[model samples]
Structure formats: structure tokens, C-alpha cells
Target chain A: MISFQHNRREFLKSSIGLAGLTLPTFLKARAESVGSRIPHKAKSCIIVYTWGGMSHYESFDPKPEAPADIRGPFGNIPTKTPGIRFCEYLPKLAHHSEQLAIVRSVHHKHGGHQQGMYINLTGKDPVGGIKAKSRKNWPSITSMISRFHNPTVGTPAAIRMPYSMYDNGTMMAGEGAGWLGSKYDPILLRTPAGKPYAGVNRYNDRELKLERNIEKRRVTDRLGLLDQLDNSLSHTINGSTPYERLDHYGQMAADMLLGSPVRRAYELEQEDPRIREMYGDHIGGQTLLLSRRLVEAGVPVVQALCSASDLAGGSGDNWDTHRDHFPKMKNRLLPVFDKSVSALLTDLEMRGMLEETLVVFLTDFGRTPKVNNNGGRDHHPGVYSLAFAGGGIQGGLTYGSSDRKGVEPGSEACSPADIHATVYNAMGIDHHTELYDQQGRPFQICDGEPLPII
Target chain B: MVGTFNVMEKLYYIFAIVLINSVHPLQAEPEALRDIERLNGIALKLPEGGWEVGFQLRGQKLNDEDMEAVVRLGSIVSLNLRDTQITSAGLAHLKKLSMLRRLHLERTKVDDAGIGHLTNLQKLEYLNLYGTKVSDEALEHLGQLHRLRKLYLWQTLVTQKGVNKLKNINPKLDISLGIDLTTIVVTNQKSEAKKKTEDLPQLEWLPEEGAKRPPDRSYTGSFIMVYFENNRSKPVKLYWINYNGEQTYYANIDAGQRREQTSYSRAVWLVTDLQEKRLGYFVTDQNTSRAKIPLE
Candidate 1:
């Protein structure tokens, strides 16, 4: 049987991690949504965010009958699922199709990179065509989950691997704890240690290391000094923004930094050699492995940026294939994605983590139907594909589809909000539950109705 | 009674004038009309920007010289030169068409040299080199076209390796690399790559340099970016040989400073100091926008 059994303390730790600080506030508001108290179907979630828009036509929704120009290059290949076809490049994913559910009709309105990313990551539209990211933007789905299920132990509630989504010199929106306090922000494992790309960020300077000459007595003295300083500040502050609350966050950060389990979770080198080989040495593969380790170590959420970092300078090769699309997908992009995703699914299933772990695959949006003059596709917000598996999600099924030319949604059109709702349902969080912002303004976590299939 | 009659007559004339003006709005010729007849190309001004130059019918009339003269007008959105008498020399004229979205060079003498001229056409979306002398080398020139969608290499000299190389640049690009169903080619199952210190050295981090950069921010040009990634522990002064073969002082890059800039294609980076003492040099190629100088 797929085990959903973890220690009760682990469960409580994840659900109400801010025991000494924010627990009272949660308890008072908990009665509004009794569903928040229910047992979660999934213990963890690994969201593989494929930034820069992976093409639907080339990956999940291959229309071979369409014109050569519309269909592009690759032909369709049979998956393990009956009557379902994927791109020829995704050979490994095709074999493991039985363990996956491909949703092919997730559509939205934002076409720009920042706008689409905002909607996809947060399930909320930008206040306007908000270009630069700000603190006013809606909190990411991971942040909302972190707020609901705060990790109790030294482990953080959520983490993001390698680096955050960046285009040119500007950082994209919706990859942070907007509206939510900075404490709920996902811990970013920027890069690994000496290896830089393979090992977890825990193997680097992120893990707390005392200076060579500084002894434990000096550290204790400094803490005492900090406490005295806090007492002095407390006299002046009259509001609830007290020194104790700041100390709570500081204490949590210190605990996380000094934690051994968190560091061990990021140590990919300690994993079995065969298992490491299963997930390729590529950045995406290693990051997914790290995500699995994190979830196993009691992290509720791990958002991974599935991309090849080597392509940053080479005409921006992170899935934004506006030209030479087929060559890139066939040779570099698709092969890495197919191998890594397949390995993750297989590894999770073998380890019996799939049943209690929701694996969500997402992208910015779909590409245009008509190929452009540069032999590539432009941004199209009409329709795209995303996927969810494990965590009570049925496998070997395609939820919805695009039109004949793979342009717009044909039937069962879904939005990013609906996908968010489905994910919350899988996690056993009430989709209709209301959460307050920094100013105490009430807002629904997800606006769209949850899919009946989940 | 005479005044009212005169006023009524004036109103009728005014109404007639308004009706005439609405029906017959004046039309101006397109911006390229002055030279369109000489080039035998149709020019239609877009409502937004640039001109759509169509040479579908009389493409054979335009030669290399005519192509040069016509492209000088600039702001061309689309250029259809199918079955034209133009050669590789004519492609140099298309370098200024930064707004070009569609280009058809089918059945022309355009080859790899001609395609090289189109590397700067960043907005070019549709490129048809069908029935031309284009080979594997033509794909090299197309690496910078991040917006390309439909490429027609049908009946050309492109191989599977060449097409795969181009696909690595932009995975979404739909190129016609003619995979015949009749031939069942078996690919070799190679062993996994041997474990190395670093498989992809281009992506490795260099020693951090402490050199400060001026905040002028006006230096902008389309060139291969050369990154002075000092993999060693020491500081190095960087120099580059320009097109004129003169070695000029670039910068004194500190060990902790990781500096990168768009530079010349065949630019040779000579690592030296203020005393003209030579350390080493890294020669950059056209294929990649980056070149790391890992001084030992």
C-alpha cells in the first residue's frame, strides 16, 4: 500500500509551524473553513515550472494530420495510454505515460512573459498589465500553501532550486511570497557548492558555518547583546510589531540554517549511485532529485525551474523558441525534459511517494498555431497544456484538448486558476477558503472552480 | 424673403461639399513608390510601420544591384524574392531590414555567404531557402534568429546533423529536414559520458573579479559577447585585436570581477598587463556569443 503515514508531530509541524507566534491567529480564523483541519491527501508537492513557455503542439498535443507548417517537424509516437500520442522526442515520457495525466487545454489571456508567469504561478491576474514585480502582487501558490501548512521542524515549508526565473536582466514576477510576509518566502537554493550545478544549495554557504576564530562563547555573548538591544527597542514600540515577533523569524532562520536534516536532504551525493544515474547529471534532473529529497525530509512544497542554465547567453534558449524551434527541442530541450521527468515519475512511484505527493507540471502559455517567418512560434495565450499526477490524481488520462490546429481550446477549457484549484483539492485544502493579506483584507486562495476529475 | 433664400442656397452648397470630400479622400503613394518601378517589386505601406515588398510575379527582374538599391529604402517587413536572379552579393543589402518578418529566397543563387548577412535580422520569422544551394553551413548563420518559425530547406543540401544543430539553437523552429519513412536508419546507442570535473566548462563559474565598471550604459551593439572569466586565482589585464589588426587595451579585469561584453566576431583576446607582457589569448568564433578566458 502507498503509505501516507508520517509521524503526527511531523504533520502538526507542517500544518501549524508557527506554534509560538502565528498559531493563535490561525486558531481564531480556523473555524471559518473546517476543511483546513482535515487530513491532507498529499504530504508534499513538487511543482516543475517550465518557464519561457514549452510548446504544447511539440510536447503533449501533437497534431500530425495538420499541415507540415502548422505541425512543425516531429511526428507523433504512441504512449502507454491507449489512443494518446506525444512528440517523438519524448520517448522516455511516452513509456511512463501510464503514470501521468496530461491536461491539454489550460488556457489564459496574458501573452507577455511577465504577465503569463504571474497568472501561471499565482493563479491571479496582475492588478493591471503590471510589468515590474512588486510586493502588491498576489502571493504564489507555494506561499499560500506555506501559510496554510507551516513546517514545524527545522525544515522550511518550501524551496526553489538553482535560481529564480529571470529574463534578460529583469526578474519575472510571481515567483515569491507577495502579500504574504517575507518569512513565508520559499528558500532559494541558488546553486550547489563546489560542483555548483549538481549538489544542493545546502552544500554551499547557505548552510550556517561559524567563522574559524569565533568560538561558541562569543556567539552566546552576541546573542545576549542582541537580546539586550531587542529589550531597548521593545520599550519604544507600542504596536504588535514587537521585537519578539522579529525574534521568532530570526530564531526560525537560525534553526533552519543549523538544521542537519535540511542539509542532508540537499545532499544528492549521498543518494545511491544508481539512483543518481537514473536522474541524469543535467541541472533539471539533479534539481528534481533534490526536490524529492526535500519533500521526503518534510518540506510541503518544492518549486523547480526546469531549464538548461547553459543556454542563458545563446539567444535565450530557456523554452522561448521563437526560431529554430524544432532543432533545439529535438537535440537539447526535449531530450533533457523527457529523461528527467520520466526518471522522477519512476523514482517517486518506486519509492511509494507518488500516492501522497502531487507532481504538477506547468508552463507560461502555449505557442502560436501558425509558425512565424523565423521558423518558430510566437506567444499564444489561447490554449496550452499542463499536467498533474499522483496525490489521488488518476493516471493515463488526458483531461482536455485544443482545436484541430492546436491553437485554442476546443472542449473543457481550463485556466491557471482552475489548475490551482485542482492542486488545492489534491492537497485537501479547501479551494474556497479565504486568506487575509498584510492589511487584513480577505481574499479567496483560488477563484476558479476545481476540476471534477481530481 | 431674399435673405432666407440666400442662406438656404449656402447651406445646400456646404452639404454638397461635405459629401464630395467624404467620398473622395486624397490618397498618397507608398513611401517606396519612387523606386518601386525600377526594382520591379510591389511596395505596400503597413498601417503600423515598414513596407511589405512583394516580388512574387516579377521576381526575375530584380538583380543583385536592384536588390541593393531597393533595400536602401529600409523598413521592409517582408521581401519575397522567389525565383530571383540575385546572388549572395544581394543578401548584404538585407542587413538593415531589422523589421523584416518574412523573407523568401527560393530558387536564387543565395548560399551560406548570403545567409550570413541575415544574422542581424532578429525579427525575421519566415525564411524560405527552398530549391537553393543552401547546405549545412547556412544553419550556422541562423543561430541568432530567435523568432524564426517556418524554414523551408526542401530540395536543399542540408543533412540530419546540420538540422539537429539548428534545432539546438531554437527548439520551436520548424525546419524541413526531410525524414523519409522509407529509410529505417538505426542510431548507435552510445555509453554515458564519462564523469569529469566539469562536462560543460562554458557554464562553470570563474573567479570573481573586483574591477569596477563605469555606469555609462550607452555601449550597445550586436556582437558576440566575450566573457573574461578568469578561472585562475590571479588578476589579468585584457586586450583585443580589432578588425584593423591593432591590439587595443580593453580593461584591467581583477580576479574577482567577471566581465562580459559584446565584441567583434573574430576578436582575439590577448591577456597582458600594462607593461605589454603577454599571458595568453582566447580566440572567439561566430557560432557562440560567449568566450571564457580561463587564465592559468
Candidate 2:
């Protein structure tokens, strides 16, 4: 009689299981159903966003065959891969070609920085007037990937370092969690070491300034205050209310500040000075270093803006090279970027973390093929280049190509959505899966197929 | 007819139960998995088969006993015991994980004895034994791991002879024998000395009274360093003309003192008195340069 009763219960449980599928359970079911359809190679992801549009002609897709006006002054050099070539300025990165998979035909329609950045980061087209904190916007790639990750206690699911993206004082949209809500927003952390980028870095109360040197006792005191507030408000709040979420953040902040491995990771002085020099003594380099550390501390996703926080009309150490582009790329930008990124790749490889940690490169758009009278390239949305390394990505391969004149995609054209899908595929996420917004409206996460590069 | 319907329902329920159990395959020992996780070990189920367990993050408290619990779950494809308290004895449990492809035992107390157990892990592709006390004997055991592609012997007791011997066995293996620590210090010192002795290009200073007033505002350019020397008798205040043409105060350099300032090329720096009175200005270039405040 008891066995009969248990069988009836099991029948009921199986019927209801499909409807009550949590993320982890759903993923497990999906994994089992697919049975090796997707390879889950990436344990963590690091998105390196070059805020301003990096030039394809100068970085990955050098058109030595193009006319002088289109090719600019820099010559091309052979990479480790015999057929592949990079700009003369990026010699260090050229040597690391074996680990890089450069896609040269990524095209998008949005030419403006805001829309271009929005499309690149969110993998979604921008509607009218998208605000940074609006919940209606699609979650950033970092936030969306983080939603699938279940980090250990007190560890953030996602983190973005240095500072937020801004253009001419206005903060860019699509950096936050968006419709996924604040719970999934990547925590913003300030890099505590190295030379500062020559531009404005605005900070609000929400950013975790680890450089403040806050003592453990002060964190305890703050937690005590929060405890008092919780005691007073616990009765008023019923379930997971906004106040409760804020309380949760407070506790997490305390945990990170008091004794979390993340706090120890922030102590850059503890790192070997040799490794620090390898990454270069720049804010951009240190941020990448911090991203590696956070991944070591179990943060699932980290987005590093590898440029100045604000692109004040092409005035600082940013990729928006409106004037003097050749000299800037030669002297200031390329050296640091080339050295730091190569160092990161070497470090991760030596530590044996590269196999499981995915490093991706994203940008606003590509620079124009023709050098303007001011010796700079304007925003060219026709086509661009991006790259992926590690995390099971097959290296020393170029997936697509731009036209000989460097005007637009010539072959194997792809979109930013395809890039996002590739990332999802590497991270073992079903890109076709659906997520619900706060209003319980279901939306498909990605609308593109994963590229075969992975 | 009623007795027949009851039997049919019972059989249908039994079929559903079997299907559900097969699909879910309840974890063999949930409590044991939880126990290992409680010690800050992460056990992730891979999409293919087996698990990738890592205890590198906050797993300092984890000891040899935890390995026993880890092996109980079985089919661990990748295991990271970096910076754990596990000794040689703990590795005995790892023999059950024949499917293991990657193992990180760096910065642990594991010696040659621990590595001996890894010989049977024929499928292992990566082994990180950096910062261990493992000697040539460990290498002899690892030579049997023909499938091993990467081996990190940095800071280990293994000699070049052992590495060469292993290389002879598997020529395709990528071994990393990291550089000595002492060389890094020497290189850093050499670089610092070189930087100090390097000459900086001089910037042409425009007196406040003479020459066309510097452009109303600064234009953005590449990053460069400027060494500003206040040679004037009185202390001078330095301000950078921002992109918007506003004077943003940067530093207050005392007489005869030099300040190393980071700025972008084509940026304008204005020198002033303590009372906010403007004196002269200098414009930065692409290279690291010296901006000397005139004595006159």
C-alpha cells in the first residue's frame, strides 16, 4: 500500500516538474536532452569592451593591398599564423596569433556611439530613448550570462571594473541588468592600482571603491546599523521586496569588505611585481589583471572597459581617434593594449586558467576606411573586427573578411547577435532559451545562431 | 471491469515513476557532495559527462578528508586542488577519477608520492605541479601519462635532466619551466635606472604677456608624461585647460620642485600665482617632456 502511494506521488511530481523548472534544473534537463550538442568549456567569461570604435585597418584587418588613403601609414606584419597579419603597431599581439580567432566582418547599422555600444553590449537593437537604468532595456551580455551562473555564497555573479561607460558626460545605456532587474546587474568595482587614464572618472554611491582603504571595524559598524534597520523593517516587508533586495546588497557588500576572497584579490600589492609589470603600469592593464583575479575568486563574468571611462569628444586615451590617429595608435594606445593583452594571455596560459576562461573583445564599431583630412577615421558601421580566445575557441583562425577596400563585409558576414550566441554556446547556454521580464512577459534571449568559431 | 481499470492505473503510475527516475537519476550521495561544497569546493556538472571540481577559491581550510567525499560522487573530469591543505595521502582517492583530464595540484604539500598515483590517469591532458616539492622521481611517474600535453614544473625540485627525459618520451608536450625570481628584480632595477637617465624633450613655454594666447581650450590626444619644474622664486599653481576651455587646477608646485604629471598630448597647462593670477603656459606633445617655469 505504501509503495503504491509513493508511485502516485512520483507521477504527480514528474507532471509538475516541467512547469516548476528553476534555472539550474532547467539547464540540467536541457544538457541531458541535448546530450553533447553544446560544449560547456567556459567556466568564466571576461568581456573586454573597447568603448570607442577601434580601427579594423589598424588592428586586425590591415588592408595592405588597399590604396594608401584607405590603408593609412602603418604597414602590416606577419603573425605567428603564416597567413594572418596585424598592424605594425600591434607586434606583441601579432605573436599571440595562435590563441586569437579574429572575426573581421562584424557589421551593424548603428553608427552613433550610444546605439553602436548598445547593440554591441546587449545584442539587441535600441528603441527610442534608452536610458542606462531603465528596466525595459535588454540586459547586457555580462548580466545575461551571469543570470545563468550560480556563484558561491558572497561571490558576485558578474562584475565590471574601472568605471562605467560615458560619452560627453552622459552615461551610456545597456551596461546594467535591464529587464533582468538589479539583482543580476554586474557589480561595478574600481581598479585600485596603476596609472590613471587621462580623462574624467565619475563615481556614484553605488560603485564599490575598494581603494578607499576602509577598515574591517568600520564595515562591522555599518553592518550593525544595517542589522538595526533590518530589525525595524523585517516586519513591514512581506517577501522579496525592494527593501529586502537592498538589504541583501548590504549584506553582500559587508561580506566582500570583511573577509571575502574578492577583497583579498583587490589587494594588488600582494601580487608579484613582475606580473604587474608584465600587464603594464596602466589603468587598462590593471583592470584586466583584476578581472583575472575576480575570475579566480569565482566571479562568473567580468566586463572590463579597456579605455577611459568617458569619451569626452575624442580628447583622452580612448579609441575614438578623431584626429592624430596614427601617432596616438603608435605611441600611446597600441603599446599598452598590445603588451597588456598579450601578458594576460600568457599569464592565464601559464596558470592553466585559459582553457576554462573565455576572453572576448568588443567595440563600438569600426573606423572608416579612408583617413580624413585631420588624419583620423570616423565611425564606420559598415564592418568591424572582434576576437575570442581560450575557452575552447579554436585559435589562429580568421572567421570572416571585409572587402579589399575595407568598406564593408565581403564574405561570411555576421552580426553582434551572432557573437553573443557564440559566447552563449561556449558558456553552455541555449541561446534560444526564453527569459521573463518583471511583468512576466517572455522574451527570447538571443535571435541569432552561434558562429562556428567555437 | 473496475478491477481491470485499477490495475491499468497502477501500471501507468509505475511506468511514469520509472521514466522520471531514469531522466533525473538522483545524485548518488547528495549529502557527500554538499559536504565537499561546504568546504568551499565547487562541483560543476559538465554538459558532456563527469564533473569539473575546483577548490582553488577559498579552499584553504579543505583537508585530505574532503578528498574522500569528493571521490564518492565519481566521474570528476577536472580537479583543481590548488592551495589546499591536502597532502600526498589525499591524492590516493583521485585514482578513482580515471576520466580526469586536468589536475591542478600547484602550491600544495603534495610531493612525489602524491604524483605516483597520477600515473594511472592515462587520459590526463594537463598537470600543474608548480611550487611543489616533487623531484625527478615524480617526473618518472608522470612519463607514463602519455596523454599529458601540458606540464608546469615551475619552482619545483625537478632538474633539467628530468624535464629532458620526459621530453624525450613525449616530444609534443609543452613544459613551462618558469624563470627564476631573482632575475625579475634585477630587470626591474635596470629598467628604473634607464628611465631616470633618459632625457625628456623640452616644451617651449609662452609668457602670459607675450605670444598669441594659447588656444581657448585643450584638445584630446594620446597619453604622455610631463615633468614640470617650478624654477620661479614664488610657488606656482598648475592648471590644465580642459576640453571645455575651463582651467582645472591640478597641482601646487613649490619653488625649485618638480612634479611628474600625466597628461594627453596637445593639452595646455597654465602656471599661476597662489592668488589665481595667470603667469605662463606650456603645451604638451606626443613624447615625455619637461615644462620648466621661467626664472624671469
Candidate 3:
């Protein structure tokens, strides 16, 4: 009787253990089935973030019928699409409308720059006193998307060029890998060649100047010096134990500098001069050119901030046109933007890279409908515009719309999270998928349904 | 009792094997498909019961034998062989992929003879033959694909006549012949020449000892090109006043040398002697103009 009881207990224990092991397998099968439903079209993503709030009325949704105060001084020009019209300043981009899917009904509630940037970048509302590089925040969209991509060994998973986003002098949050740990943080690289944006750009000292003159023997010594500098900087910036000791960024930098496709991609001088001129000689144009090269070099995601690094009270070359809005948009901003973005589309199509590369335009909330006393537009979180192209997206289609007055969403209202969900859907990431934090706490990556634009 | 326990253990082992197999159904896939995957070719299974194979990344070593391995997988919906080492002879193996919906043969060696095998692929929707050696004869073979929606013949030997013929067969077909590359270059150069002759804002040269000295540091501004004509008797050192107000050496302009310097508007350029004594400076503007250093 005793032996029989022992055998029964052992049998139950084995059955339970097997059941526990098979449960995850069954769950994985279901998860994969859900994921395979969405065809994976984008192998890489290029995020064009216009730092300050890019005016919807001036870029994609020009309202000719609105009052002068609401419509501002810009006129509407007909695009390739019959019914679609863009601001007169964007004549070049108007020609490429067939390849763009403009979303004019995106809106959020954040009015401040930091809060608005946090929502746009991470697709999550700020919780409380959120600080940059804090582990309690959500992972940025670039970092999250890059986590799923497996690039060739040596290439950084994600890279943000030129400079980090800053307001006056304060660095913005939602630009780092939060709960995903420091490993998934997007590496910041300075655009080696290009005219610098007019503003006080902080955090420009972290660049590795791998000039051709550096001898092979001194390479090791240079790398060692970089490591020490990075360690000390990380300590001061992070205000915690060094994250590099736990991440592979230091080793990856060495690997890239020693000789990799990424190193070759950085030599912009080798590109055809005509192509460089086509992108324009501005920093904005060069940044987009570098983005194309980096994508070809196998970097999964790249975020190019199109505006000046710092929004120093809208004084320099930023989209923050709080004063002299018409002159700024017509002279400094529109020409470079229209030319470079159109060149990118044309270049990608000619090389057959557009089919696999996704280009997205994001910004803070749209400008207000009423012209301000300063002769500029104020922050309007009521309704705004964003755009997506390539990577299997149906072009020449406008997904949503604002009212006639350009104040609020009139039809197919969507949020920044919904746009994020659409991107994940295009890139083959299941929006409802859960990722665990360092503490093993599972969090749903996104909470919105994907738009039908795909 | 001992015998019963042993039997239960054997049942557990069988159940575990079944569960593991169900979890990884790819284990049951043919070894040829796995071999292609080992070569970094993606063999993703579509939810609608077909495979999507791509060799766009790391496909330099792929040859005719690899195409045979791809055919063995059977139900491929989309196949991307762009930039691969596959030849016209290798495309003979693609005849078996009748279920293919989208095919990317761009930048490959596939020509008219190779494209002939794709006529039987009735379900094909997208075909990209750009940068290939295909001529009008290839379009003749492609026109037979009635369901083809998008065809890219850029940089090919195909002419407008071939594209028109394909369009006649299927009026709904979207054919892209792309712009000529050389024409763009010529036009851009012409426009560039025209721009140089246009009116430009001339920058004022501020002598070092003059009342109106240039700003100590450069400020960020729009991109512009400045033509510096060194009329001085000796070679002068050109230094850019950096954002930090520090002197960063850029180049040395020999006497009577014309150096085209790319700079930004509002940037200050200081000219000095070989001994680094400042002579004169010029602040750039938003137009391309000439900055000539006068002989003192």
C-alpha cells in the first residue's frame, strides 16, 4: 500500500511539471498566429521628428477656406492627387504626394514641450516627475522597435544622429530605453559633416572622431580614452551605477571603429556629389542622407530630428515659429525640408529600397487655429497632422481629417498611440505583445488599435 | 506498483515529445529549407498557408543550387532574390513557384530568357526587373502575366514601346520606366551655373584694425558657398571662429588661388598671416558670393 501511494504521488508531480512546460508552448503558438497575420514589410524605419510643433496648416492640411487668422499667410497648391492640396511653401513635397499617406486628425492633450515630446516619442502619457534616462519610464518607440530587429553583429541596434532634443537647455525625456534597461537605449551619434543648427546644442562631446590620420597603434589608446571618458560621463549624467558596465555600447563602439560596414557608411565624402547636392548642403539634408546610409548599413531604426537641437525660445532654425511664422516657414524651414524629403523618396525608389524602408514624420501637437499677438501660432493640442510613406503603406491616401476651421478632429479621430500601433503593425510587431522589464514585470507595449491605412 | 510507475514514466516521455514537436513545427520542415535559412535567407511562413522567401541580405553566395532548395519548399507566395548571385540559368528553377504573388529580380542577371519562365505564374501581382539586362523581349514575356499590377523596368533595355505594349495587354498595369540619370545631372549643372550668375548678397570684409570688427564666434545659419580669392602677396591661413569663440584652422589659401569654401550664413571667417597675425575677416550671408582679401 505504501509503495502504491508513493508511485501515485510521483505520477501527479511529473504530470504537473509537464503541464507547466507545455502551457508556454501553447501560448507561443497562439501569439505567433496573431503575429503572422500582419505581413512584415518594413525591414528598417527612419523617423523624421520635427522637434517643435510643426504646423499642420502649413505642411499637409492647408485650409484655404478658413479665415485669414486661421489659414495664416500661406496659400494652398494642388498636389499630384486630384483633391489633395499642400501649403504653397511645400511645392517639392507636393509632387511626391502619391507616395505619402497624410494623417491630419492626430491629437493629444499635452501642451508643454516635454510632455508633448514624451507622448509623441514613447506613446505614453507622463506619469510623474519623469527625468531623462530614468528606469521607471517607458521605452522609446525607436528602442522598442529595434529590440525586435537582429542586425549584423557590430552595428548599433538603433542610432539617433546630430543631437538630442532639448528645450532651452533641459534635455527631454522619452528619448531613452526606460524599463527595457540600458542595452536597448538608442546610441547618439553626431552628424560628422553638415552646417550646425543655430542654438545651444548640449551633449556634443560624446562623438568618436575616427579620422583617417589616426595610426593603427594609437587606435587602441584612443578607444581606452573613450572608455574612460564614457564611464565618467555616464556616472555624472545617469547619477547611478554605470550602465555601460552592464551594456555593450562601449564594446560595440570599438567594434564599429575597428572596421565595419557602419564605419564605411560614415564616409559621406565617397557619395556622388550630385546626389549630395540634390539633398541640399544644409545639415537637415545631410542628416537625411546619413539616415539612408545607416539604414543600408543595417541599422534597424534611425531618428533624425529635423529641427535645431534646442528650442531656445524659437529664435533659430526650428519649427517652433512662435514669431515671424511666415518668414521662417517660407525661408529657412520649408525649402530644406521639401527638397531633402522629396530627394529621399526619389532616391529610395530608384534603388528599390523604399519597398523595405519605412519613413515616418512625427512632431509635437499642431499650432493653434488663431494667429497669436506675436504674429505666430501657439500650441494647439486639439488637432494636428503626421505622415507615413513606403514600407507597403498605401500612398496618396489621407487617413483622417480636421474640421473646416482646422481646430479639431472632424472625422476618424486618432491619437499618437494609434499611429504607433500602425507603425508596429507595418513592422510586424504585434501591438498587444507584452515585454517584461528588468524586474520581470510584464507591460503591454501599446494600447491602441492600428489604423486601416495599411 | 513498480511496474505501473515505469509505464507512467514512458507515457510522460511520449507526451513531452509531442508537446515539444507541436511547439517547434519548423523542426519537421525539409532540410533544404533549413539550409537556405542557414544562409541568412528568410523563409517565413505566411498565415494563409504559404512561405515568403527572401535572399536580399547576405545573398552573394546564393546560386542555382540554392534556387532548387527554395523550390523544394513548394508553396512560396513571395520571393525576393534582389542583388543575389542567381543567373538566367538559375531562374529555370523558379518555374515551380507558380503560387508566387510578388517577385523581386532587381539588380540580378536575369534577362529575357529567365523572365520567360514567369509567364505561367498567373497569380503574380508585383514584378521588379530594374537594373537587369531585360529588354523589350522580356516585356513580351511579362505581358502574358495578366494579373501583374506593378512592373518596374528602370535602367533596363526596355523602351516606351515595350511598356505601351504591356499596358495594352493589361490597361490596369502600373509601369515605371523611371527618369534618365544623365539628364538629371546635366540639368542640375545648368541650373547650378544659372544660380551662380544670379544676384547675390556681397559680404563686407572687416579689417582687423577697423572700427567694425567681425563677431568673435560663429552663429548657426543657412548653408551657403563662398568663393575666397587670395589677392594678398603671401599665402594666408584661414581659420573659422568656432561656436566657442576659439580659432579652428580650416585651410591655407596661396596667393592668387581661388578656393571655394562651403560655409553657413552668419559664420565668421578670419584670415591671418603664416605667423597667425589676424589681417582681415569676412562674415558670410545667405547667398553664394565672393570674398576677396585686398592687398595692404
Query: Chain B TM-score of all predictions, in order?
Result: 0.49, 0.67, 0.62
| Winning candidate number (DockQ) | 2
Query: What docking tier does model 3 reach?
Result: incorrect
Compared with the true structure, all predictions reach lDDT values of: 0.66, 0.80, 0.77
Model 2 residue A87 distance off true place after TM-score fit, in angstroms: 1.6
Give TM-score, chain B, model 2: 0.67
Compared with the true structure, what per-residue lDDT tens digits does model 2 show for residues A1-454?
A: 4663343334223222222211222233333444433567788999999888999999999998898789987899999998999999899899889999999999999999999999999999999889888898899999999877656545778899888988988888999999999888887888998788765666642577666744466456655654454454433233332433543354354345445778788888888888887787888888889888888878889999999878877767789987657766877788888988997887777777787899999999999987765557989989999999998899999998999988999999999999999999888788988889999999889987888978
Number of the predicted model whose TM-score against the real structure is largest:
2
The DockQ-derived docking category for candidate 1 is incorrect
Rank order (by DockQ, best first): 2, 3, 1
* Candidate order by decreasing TM-score: 2, 3, 1
Single out the weakest 10-residue window by summed lDDT for candidate 3 chain A: A20-29
Compose the digit string of candidate 1's lDDT tens values, residues B126-235: 88887689999989889789999868776678888998999999898977643232343322222222222124234322232424321211121223445555555667
Off by more than 4 A, model 2: A1-37, A211-254, B1-28, B38-40, B159-161, B178-198, B201-293
Best by lDDT: 2
True-vs-predicted CA distance for residue B224, candidate 2, Å: 9.6
Error in Å for residue A387 of model 1: 0.4
